[model samples]
Target: MDLMALIQQALEASGKLRDLSKKLEDADFKMILADLHSALADAKLESGELKIKLALAQEEIVRLKQVIEQRDKGKPTYNSEGVYTFEGEVGRFCTACWDSDERKMRLTDLASEFRFVGQWECPKCHAGYGAKDA
Candidate 1:
């Protein structure tokens, strides 16, 4: 049983013992009552410690869930042009790399002198965007 339930039962039993003691004047009964009270006090202390641990565990679970949600939200999504948007941020990503491997292969703009101007190229896969390869 859990510490809380055990502590609660101990408390209830202590109350019943006290009530029963009032009807008897035996010395042995009084000694037993003293021991029961001591044990109940110890149980109460242990219950408090268990409650703190339970609270800490619950807090950790909440923190881990929040971290997972943030990671999933940061994942990129594909646009109509087959490029992935970086968590809604500016930047055209390689859809092939991201969709196939979850790798963020950013596309770099080709220079005007390269004939591939206004196009983006994947640094990792060497794939070209816009106008295709001549």
Candidate 2:
């Protein structure tokens, strides 16, 4: 059974045990005692089952996390060059390329081409050619 179901069962058993203890002074206490014992046993078994299920769930979570980390490690990283290439749909473009001779054209100039190359604002134009721009 699932963790939630086991927990609910355990809680119900505990409540029943409390009620049984409250009536321990009555003549029918023997019958209630037997039922409480059975409930206690069931609660213990359910608790063990919950522990096993939690361990399995934790193991799977760790495995999935490792898989994600490995996948991210395999991906390409972009540095100061600002150029990155990926295997499929993912790609990175040099932001400075927009201000260079290679990208003198603008969005308004690319009416026929129907495509914009590099970033919207030229990094070179904003930062200048060297650190002096700062």
Candidate 3:
């Protein structure tokens, strides 16, 4: 039915064949060989079916992934310029007080640039904003 089931069936058939080989002198050796042959045939058939099922499943997964990518493409995204505009007010205030007040202000004016600063505060009033906290 599935790849795993087919593999298990193949393993079971192999174990039976091993057992039959170990007991070659037994009276039912011929019958065991016949049963092993039948099991091997079934395993082969199951493996073929499993291969087809896996191929179909992989195709479906690819199709679904493409659909998801297309859906995401339609979603809105904030540009670097837009973020700079939105945070301009705070950045400007920090720059103005960078030298006058000394509360440790670390602000980046360029939104396109990425940095790992811990804190940003206004030197004049010590008012700060933590982007990570947000």
**Best-matching candidate per lDDT:** 1
| Cα lDDT tens digits for candidate 1, 32-85 | 897888888887988798889989999999988876765686878767765788
Q: Candidate 2: deviation at residue 62, Å?
A: 0.7
Q: Candidate 2's residue-wise lDDT over 86-127, tens digit each?
A: 344343433344324333211112223322342322334432
Which scores higher on TM-score, 1 or 3?
1
- Residue 33's lDDT within candidate 2 is 66
Order of quality (TM-score): 1, 3, 2
> Across residues 1-134, which tens digit of lDDT does each residue of candidate 3 receive?
75657667776776777676776766587666767667777777777888799899999999888767644544222333221112322343343343343222434433323223324444445444444543
The local distance difference test score of each candidate is 0.79, 0.51, 0.53
* Better by lDDT, candidate 3 or 1: 1
TM-score of each: 0.41, 0.37, 0.38
Deviation (Å) of 94 in candidate 3: 49
Off by over 4 Å in 3: 1-27, 75-134
RMSD vs true structure, all candidates: 10.3, 11.3, 14.4
